[model samples]
Target: MRLTRYLLALFLGLGLCAGPGLADTPGVGLKPDLRLLVDISGSMKTSDPDNLREPAIELIVRLLPEGSKAGIWVFGEDVRELVPHGVVDSAWRERAREAVPQIDNSGQRTNIPAAITAATYDLERLDPGYRTSIVLLTDGKVDVAESPMVNASSARRLLSATAPNLGATGIAVHTIALSNEADWPFLRALARSTSGIAEKAESPQALSSIFVQALEMVAPTARVPLSDSGFAIDDSVSEFTLLVFFGGARNRLELVDPDGARYSANSSDVDWYQNQQFALVTVASPSAGNWRVKAPDSASLRVNVISDLKLDVDPLPNSLPAGRQTELGLRLTEQGQVLTDAEVLAAFDLSVVITGPGGKQLSIPVSREYALPADGEYRIVIPPFDAPGRYQVVAQLQAQSLQRELPMYVEVVAPPEQPTLVTRGQEPPEDDFQAPLLWLGGVLALLLLAIWLHLRRRKRRKLEIWEKRARQLASNDSEPLEGVSADQ
Candidate 1:
């Protein structure tokens, strides 16, 4: 996630560079470029005693110079760059104007880390002359994590990771606390950390002037601090994770504009960065322009940005049985710093079906997006398959066609029983309970036939008896007729 943010910010910093706005910073000629990081977190919509958000927005719009360049970022549970930095043209202003009509401040997550990461990563690609920064105005404290409230400790950790080492980068952070009950310590530390002034909106009236003053802060000496959240060296293999701590509460955060305009971090714009944080990111070797400890604070922590040895998966096993999952051992010197997203492939023969645990076979699943745990060793679970034979396991860099395979003994383990049954002391007997019914039906049919035959025989005998009786009567009549001649 941090890496993605880095790319996004990097694009702005490297691509669409804009010019300066406020020439107020007298002789420096550094007309600061301002990107408003608005705190659209719902509380902003409250029409309070004097509708705080309306006043805040009005104050910001009024202070901008005619050609002031600004970007819009609305941060809440989910932070988004509403507008990216570019020259302040009527088109840009129109976008902002349209934004005001549709934008309502309400989100569940106050993604301070997302905002800061995007801003800082983008800042690095801008010109050294233009002053660029975020003007953050927030009424709440950093609520991060899966919790409803901003996760205090996690928010602090995140902030520490991305907190700009502006003194290291020659930029400054100006912070304004708009709420009465914000984590003063966090805000104060952010300003102090970046060697900028931190102020409070004691009253709505003072909010505007405080913002203007905050903006006027000049750029520090020009220096490029390391950009990767931390350093990633290949001391260990398999996978690695590097932790970066930037204490927003105690450092200056310099912002570089997309269009080369530099601006100080101060104003009514909460999106400008009310604070800073640290993050974990991957990096290539040489570790140029990195940073080390300069100050400490409540949000302060140490980090190791170096390439440690990684658990090498040399001659990595490439193939296994179709229905079995393979386990591999990994070792690491840096322990947590390696690639989890490395693309691993397994190849199978045509006759040997290698369906995955999900039934699909012949797939390249492992890639560079997987988050590598601190342990360099990972148990690569290969889904089971029906085919029983040797298969090849290939470890390749994600997106790179390169691949390494390991041919091994393939044993097709029987698939686990479906509708499996288990009891305390015995195996379930296999019974064909439906078989007896067929024999029972045949016997019933035979018995019915025998009864029908017996009835038929009895009826035939009765008919014969009737015939005999009739004959006897006729004979008797005839004999009698001897006495009475023609009567028969």
Candidate 2:
């Protein structure tokens, strides 16, 4: 029985070691990992006439945010890594672009199975701290060999199985069909299985645009503000969240949206992480107004919320377009709703602060206010952002003791690049999706080690018991029968 328990414990230890656990705690400050897989089969020669593939690749390589990691793969009968996975920088960008033209169309067939497998392998090699994805751009179907593993059905099945496993590891597979001839159904199904999008592009222009969009989606940017009392949510803002970190003692929090809707910390929408002293609230379709937050005064940590506030001074051509006038827009709301008409807005005083890319600061003239189609929406005009870079705009509103400020960050690229339209404002932190997996892995490893040691000690104790029993029997046999003593 003792031996049976020892064996059982040993098997349990092995079982634990076999399980690769998941991390539950979120990880912070990790960059995204994107791997691009482009089909280089002969069909591409007809489908991609303008040769926009290389240009799209180059553009994506150029625009990827710094610190993010990306790799490029060209797939034919076999897969080739045009650019090895590495952190994005000026040097890396140059190397990635240089390799784009090197992609040749010598292979006659497309082996999507091999390509996907290779990309998955590369992504798996990433430091599990990243939000990883594979952006697959293909213009044709899976035309590889007809084998159990290489046939179309087999390929789909392999991907079908791999997709969920990748998702389990926090990796997604986004598919972009560059032409109508591509296997849209299969691609879409593959992407859906992995919790990714399948985008279709029929023309070179559309494909180029999709490439930029894909890269942007793969590598998102984020900003956190340090403030107290209230933070701004843009008029154009949609859904947003507030993460409040408390310390020392529990803190009470209250949230007021633009439409005057009030929510408390114990509201149904609020999620609390008691162990971490963090509470998060997600607001859907947030009103375009300054959301007020009342946090505990004793909460010493910085408490800033990323809310929806759209206040911008944008040049028609965000590239500034030389002498064009810049359009300034602001949306006002009270409590948590949009304010329309002078009756609802009679109690408010509003002003805007404009800071140019050149560090120049000015205030928009109150007389310059013009009405828009929506209630509480206001617009004005400003001089073009002649010099290139980022500009900061802030709009302020005060109603009695309640004060709100909305901050908008705009980018003005140099001439030649088309104007960039930013529909989304500041992004939330890109927390690690793999953190839970990592934490689980660590705990499982430790548990397995402990179980192994315990089982080994139990086995040693069992062996010691058997040895003692054998010695006792041997001594009795040497002492002769009970009736016959040492004299006999």
Candidate 3:
């Protein structure tokens, strides 16, 4: 199964658990784990199991969050060998990949009992430190075994009756019946058992769709901020596919267009990590306003995307002509109150298009740096303008953490027709730079150098007397000088 291949990835990425720091605890994070249980029945052979290919593979990938862990299992009449329980890592994914291609209708019936048991057991490997979960996907009526104490129906009954135990075990079971063929009795029982809900899908496509939706519904989403020291958007956007970085775990996010038409992305068709891996959202364009989490499909983590946005170009004629040498300053602002210990992504400029007079065009790149999340004006240095004529300084403010960009505009004015370097005391002027400040600093540096030279000369004069005395003593014989130098 592809999942088998990820055994190493899972092991290295998600495992153990943590919580977002304590009130007094310093440098602490959250640890959480979610297990995926797949039902591989003979009927599943009719169509390819493993969500046809992807949904199953994504299991371990989704769990690769910081302070988190994931495990995998498949039950076909009986639970297939554990896929990624020990050292949960990329190898688990590899196994999942290996498991899917060879999946056959081997099992005659679905075994909910063994499936849930395996899932719960895999979770037991972790201590009480993590948020535990079991995600079970199936599409059939469970055939109750002829057990004296509990039949399949009775087992289903047990799941409901055993809710507290599941919770106390740090386990929560989320149930999804991929097809109408699923057994509601068992599904409902499982949900009631683990304080989870039962969601049903009508078609194969819908099934896959609901599976992804269900994952997002229960999966955690993080709130992150976007920064662009160059040009960035302060105006809000929405319906954009996005992602939020939360330390080790990233949230898969989707923006729904508020276009009066019921346009929404089916979870199965969407990617939770589609946006920049765990990015801080400043503005959700097409959204009514700035960033906020809304899971119309399922429950999602509460997140807020806010930014203090400001942009500037340097050498502030604040304006430049195309092809002229001038500095562009960029200032990105964010609400410092928020950030949550996250770092702003590296800054960059995009859309390097320049529209010059008479429709001439040119392009250039601006550079930036990253900093701690704070509500302040961060800056970037712009590169030289590339074209001539009245041009607009156009670029998109880009952050490594952002999926989209904030747009920027600059007014490019022509350089002086008869350009002349203005000297101090002669500027009525076209540019206002810190030339005076630079001159002051240069003068101070010269003064300090002169003072240092004077001190060295005085010290050299004082040392001359000692040197002459030493020379006079040396003129005497070694033994004579040693005994009578002072008397001499």
Best by lDDT: 2
Model 3 segments more than 4 A misplaced: 1-29, 46-56, 59-63, 86-102, 122-125, 144-153, 160-163, 223-488
TM-score of 2: 0.42
Clashes of each: 81, 25, 82
Which tens-of-lDDT digit does each residue in 1-488 have in candidate 3?
22212322433344311312101222122244667777667777554444453433343343344335666677776887545653345565466556555444567667777776776664446664455667787778665565645555556465655555775564667777777667777676566445455666554444444444344434333223332211222233222333333323433444433332222234444333332223222223433423334332232332322333322222123234556555443333221121122222233343344565567666554432434323322343455655432344444454333323322233453354887686767655644657877899999999999999999999999899899999998897755435556656
Q: For candidate 2, lDDT tens digit of each residue in 166-248?
A: 76776767788988899898887777667566778867555655665465455532222335666555433345556554444
Residue ranges of candidate 2 with Cα displaced over 4 Å: 1-26, 122-125, 146-150, 222-488
Q: Specify the poorest-scoring 10-residue window by lDDT in model 2.
A: 310-319
Give me the displacement of residue 312 in model 3, in angstroms: 32
- Order by lDDT, highest first: 2, 3, 1
Which candidate number maximizes TM-score?
2
- Evaluated at residue 162, the lDDT of candidate 2 is 72
Give the whole-model CA lDDT for all candidates, comma-separated: 0.45, 0.62, 0.47
Q: How close is each model in CA RMSD to the real structure?
A: 23.0, 31.7, 31.1
